[model samples]
Target: MRSYLFVPGDRPERFGKALAAGADVVILDLEDAVAAPNKAQARDNVRRAVDDGAQVMLRINGAGSQDFIDDLALLHGLPLRGVMLPKAESVGPLGELAEVTDAPVIPLIESALGLWEVMTVARGPGVERLAFGSIDFQVDLGCDGSDEALLHARSRIVLASRVAGLQAPVDGVSVALDDEAVIAAESRRSRALGFAGKLCIHPRQVAVVNAAFSPTREELEWAARVVAACERSAGAAVSVDGAMVDLPVLLRAQNLLAMAG
Candidate 1:
């Protein structure tokens, strides 16, 4: 999935719109997006969304929050694809969360301690992906929210996801709703840095995000050529084009094909 779009948990009205917007996954956010007074209602709303076949994901509050347990209870026995566990500080929380449900959990590492324990968290069972929580991450670092401030965190999440054989980490949401140019630039940068997908706040931004992440026609052609050459070479590591096509290159070609699809 190259684009994961978010809808506020309390706004069930927007869920269908988000699904129609073409995001591969739709996350009903119960964390920062939900007001405290609406937390209970949001859980019930998310449960209904999950049952609606929207490639459902629930972003629950922190592992230790009062809302987290209630969120898990509502999530249990539902036909959920996954849960996005925000503020994941340790494998212990992930372990505890998994015991309560069977859905795959995507850990959102948003704190300094979470970054410190990322590899451990990624290696935990039921972790299908690791997402960078940029807003809270900036708070954790006490740094201005900018590309420079987030490079290290993005790299760490990608590295941890790779180490655990999980899907490449999703890039954080771009808050500039009016700036398509800026959002496209950020998406390109994330793609260059090896992120497989991006999280989006607005449905209007979903197409742009998906376009930026998807392999271009030129890229797909090149990848197909390389793959065909490898096959013609009898699976040799070197291609007829004088390029070395090893496992990494092969994997990249495969991913290009996947994305092109």
Candidate 2:
């Protein structure tokens, strides 16, 4: 799941287009992007999108909002791959959501309150992944959305997710679309910081995001050799192509193999 793209739930025309746009997952957004008057339409659209059987995730409104209950009630029986709970501040709301639906919940932590309670949210039963909402988080922190400002929050999400044994936290969207080079650089930076995936705003950004996150040929080759050498050494530390492969290296090789699959 390298490229996770967003699609407005109310726009049926864009659903197939987004999937064909090379996103590993298409998030049908119902909050923030959609207007207050369009909430009902967004819910209806999300329900229809879920029925399409694609890897669709509904980004429901915040828990206390009227739209969330309505969206959940409508999406309960549908076969959505997951639900992205926005502005998650604690485990209580996620637990409530889990009680009603069994789909994997991908919580988006945006506020300071949410960041402080990240561990609690990660410990919840149904969360499969944690995503940082850089824009909202930056707003909450009253700081610019630069790497330095968001670094700690990004690392915090990664640590919290790992502690809960969930997939590595996904990096927030790169708002700049015109500067592909900047996007690539930021994507690489985020990957280096331990984010396993990125949220892309446009289709043109998908390939770059995927390429940045995917293990390179050289990386895979090293991982393969490490795997073979580890097998020979009974998973103990050993020399692989002149480099010493230890437990950390072995685990990385396993992750690479999983990515390859």
Model 2 accuracy (lDDT, Cα): 0.87
Clash pairs of candidate 1?
none
Encode model 2's per-residue lDDT on 1-261: one tens digit a residue: 888899887778888889899888888888988889988988877776666667687788898878877876876677877889999998888887877889999999899999999999998879999998999999998999988999999999999988889998889999888788988899999999989899888888998898998888998998888888878887556897787877887899989877988
Give TM-scores for every candidate, taking all chains together and pairing residue i with residue i. 0.93, 0.94
- Regions of model 2 farther than 4 Å from truth: 232-237
Clashes of each: 0, 0
Give the winner by TM-score. 2
**Residue 245 of model 2, lDDT score:** 77
Q: What C-alpha lDDT values do all the predictions have?
A: 0.86, 0.87
